[model samples]
Target: METSLEEDSRTKEFDGVIFGASDQVFSRYEDSSTEVTYTYILQTAGEFGCFQRILVALTFIPNILSAFFMLGGTFMLKMQPHHCNTDWLLAIQPNLTMSQLFNLTLPRKKDGSFEECRMYTPVQWDFDSIVKYGLNDTQDCQNGWFYLSHEWSLITEFDLVCNKASERLRAYCIFVAGLFCGSLLVGTLCDRIGRYKSILLMLMFYAVFGLGAAFVPTFSIYQMFQFGIGIAIMGYTISSISLVIEWLVSSRRVHAIVLAQCFLVLGHLVLSVLSASIPHWRLLHLVGSIPVIFLVSYIWLLPESPLWLMMRGNVEKAKFLLCRAASINKRIIPPELLQKLTNEKIHQGTIMDILKSPNLRRRTLILSYVWLCIGLGYVGLSSQLHKFPINMNGSHLAFRLVEVPARLCSIISMEKLGRRKSQVLALLLGGLTCLYSAFIPEDLTSITTTLALMGQIGLSAAFTIACIFSAELFPTGLRQVGLSFVSLSYSIGVIGTLLIESLDHDHPETFMTVCGIMTTVGGLLCILLPKG
Candidate 1:
């Protein structure tokens, strides 16, 4: 958070400028050296607007699939009103109806709902006159639970309700733990092998693992699939998007990244529709996995980032892609001119590079905090909303719908407000609104829903901005490294999301307040980061 003049000098030392490079590229240069030495892949590819469009298409589906990956858990873990099965009671009185059995055998709580975990009278296998007298003795469910609805869930199938309900949260935490591991693995692959190849591997893993999760017989086996899904989700995300983004100049970076981000929002909306329409959790996952087969075209169709190729010292390959891009855009660059562009190597980075470089180090630390906070607050609030009376389909759709406008606004504000301020503003506004909403009594449902929606919008916007901000802050070599750290933080945040289960029901204020504080702290940390 230091503001010393020395630190400012250190930030400025990251080569020439990046953000303002677009304007300078077109401006009257002082000499030939300026024009020759400074050129971005975007500037060279801008003539082919179709190229960007195609790249965006390549990036979009992966983002949607990533959202679907997480959404599967929402549907899979969905809870329903359930209680001890009436089979034993039915056996005692074979002629009794289902409703009659429930009334006679199940214990009712203060809420007038049948208790899910407990039942009236023990199953001593001695059905005497006590059955007709209505025995008052109560005991924990011994046989199995009866799900009120036909819609199957892990909660109903595995008896993850009542005391063991916390297992549901633990399951998701394990998934995110896998994501943390995946981010590191994918980051290394993307950094070493290349974006295109790394993503192909990820998409394959996603298809096999994600779809395979649907048929698992045991909850423990299902968890293994969830873990693999997490790994694939984050890997597909970083590799595909980073590849396309790295090829673009700063001017279109926000638009391209936001487009990729919007796909995730759209994916979430699609998930709501799928969850509501499909009725079965397994079918929903099956539908989501179908896209993986379609994305196989990416193997040959998607091109490697020319900048990445040059950075990898593949000048000839980079030249071929550039020619293909130029052909697609219908623009011509002189052979001599294109040859000189790949003259220097874009620095290859190791994990230590992020720590050793003063400018990169500061940006990484600040962005990591912001990423972690956004994940924590955003997931915490979303998870808390599950207890409310909001319609699952409508709320889920509306929640994702808002992100579209929020991200659009960020694209405009990013240019005007700059990275740090826009990001800080997003975090601050989201945090403050969440805190304010905590004070509103639950009876005021309308007001609370509005505030919750606003909070999501802000958090969504902050998350988008922070991602773009991170891209601009670090050099290409260190970009994936920074992404790895950010993903690790976010995965930890998702793990922390489990806390909402304990806190959301009893101490509502405590839940909202903790999420608010984290986002606000992220904002403060963002202020210390130098503008890119």
Candidate 2:
């Protein structure tokens, strides 16, 4: 009799018919009783007030760190100008200038560029013997390689130039694989353990492995750390974003998400400055990841999601958090609203929940494909930007700057046109821009550069919209799982981009064309998704 009474109370609390705020339905309750729902209570607490703003601000730290760890690789693993390390010749001729040394020991191609991987065989004789012998022989770098700049990079530190060049691609693949695996593991953890705990756990992983990446001595060990960073970053991203969105009401969710994405852009901007100022990759990575130590203080500062608490049937805790939010927002939650907050224990969603339902399965497939294209297009264009005539800093700054307007546009479009159309518009615009740029002649560097920036703008908007849309499509219980599944496709896309680059390093046009086609297809499929 006692257990049956508790079940009856749980059903009454959750089965209440609630309506939107616009309808002025706050006072309505099930059986004409005063048992309000979490949604209504969250609205009553205030949607876009002081509490939400503070949470949004806290998210910037992780987003910026995400940029550092994710895009930092652009500079950290870059291919610097290098040649065979032939400094041994200096032993015979101490006065040899760098130009003299290169002219004597290195072979030149038909276009007069020195061979980067091979140098003439060295001899013990004085420099005159080498000059007299006319140095016709060449072999793989006998000593190793020398970079124009001694600054640390994967290329310089790992000797990834000649035979080892392929290792860079392999390292990237390993990192992406980590991201894929982390999405599954962390997404499940977030749903099972609650968002706050998941964030804390992922932060620990991110900081430890990120620092480990900076200090590891060998390329093999470095790859191991990179893989760990990959997993940690994906988990951090999914958990943090989910936490933020869960706290916000539907009306403010898009705006808050857009605001958080701006921090991600700022992260890239900060990364550009740091990359320029910090010459050593290890030090740069160290600086980027070290902030997590400070961020750990969030354990005391951040609050658990009240809705999650309610879903887990910790009604008293949820009520306390709601009251706190209301107090901070300077609103009074009537005692009656808190008196009947008895929610049942909702089942935590799993990957099977997404697959068992046909509606969810369709949405997951479509959103996953969209996410995949967004990842490929965004990373592909950003990676290829250096191929243009602009300087490196300028390209990076310009690319990140575009996101400011792009995300702003996303907010407006999502609010005005709704999710499906907004996503389709952003994707198509990005796709067409990329495709058009691909056909442009290589001589038109300015045109190509401008078009690339425009394409990124569209992609940036699409990325922001996709994040919100995917979250909204799933219920709170399944939100993290659904997002993780979609994000797995993103990892696949990144890996695909890397493979394309490895296959055709010389022709970025082919890669861009492929990205454009895939993005367009993803956008067109959005039409089939159920309308908002």
Give Cα-based local distance difference scores for all models.
0.76, 0.81
Candidate 2 off by > 4 Å: 1-36
lDDT for model 1: 0.76
TM values, all candidates: 0.91, 0.91
Q: For candidate 2, lDDT tens digit of each residue in 1-532?
A: 3457655553333223234432211112211322236667777888767877788788757888888888888889888999998988888888988999999999998999999988998777767777887787788898888789867777787788888888888888888988988887888787679889988887887778877788888999988888888898898888888888767766777788898889888889999999889999889999888887888788988888876786678888888888888888888888897776776755456777667566667878999999999989898888886787877877899899989999998887876777889999999999989999989998998888888888999999999989887876765556777889999999988888888887565775788799889999999999987564
- What digit string (tens of lDDT, one per residue) describes model 1 on residues 2-42? 66776454343432233354331111121123233434444
Assess candidate 2 and give its lDDT: 0.81
- Candidate 1: the clashing residue pairs are 48-329
How many clashing residue pairs appear in each of the predictions shown?
1, 0
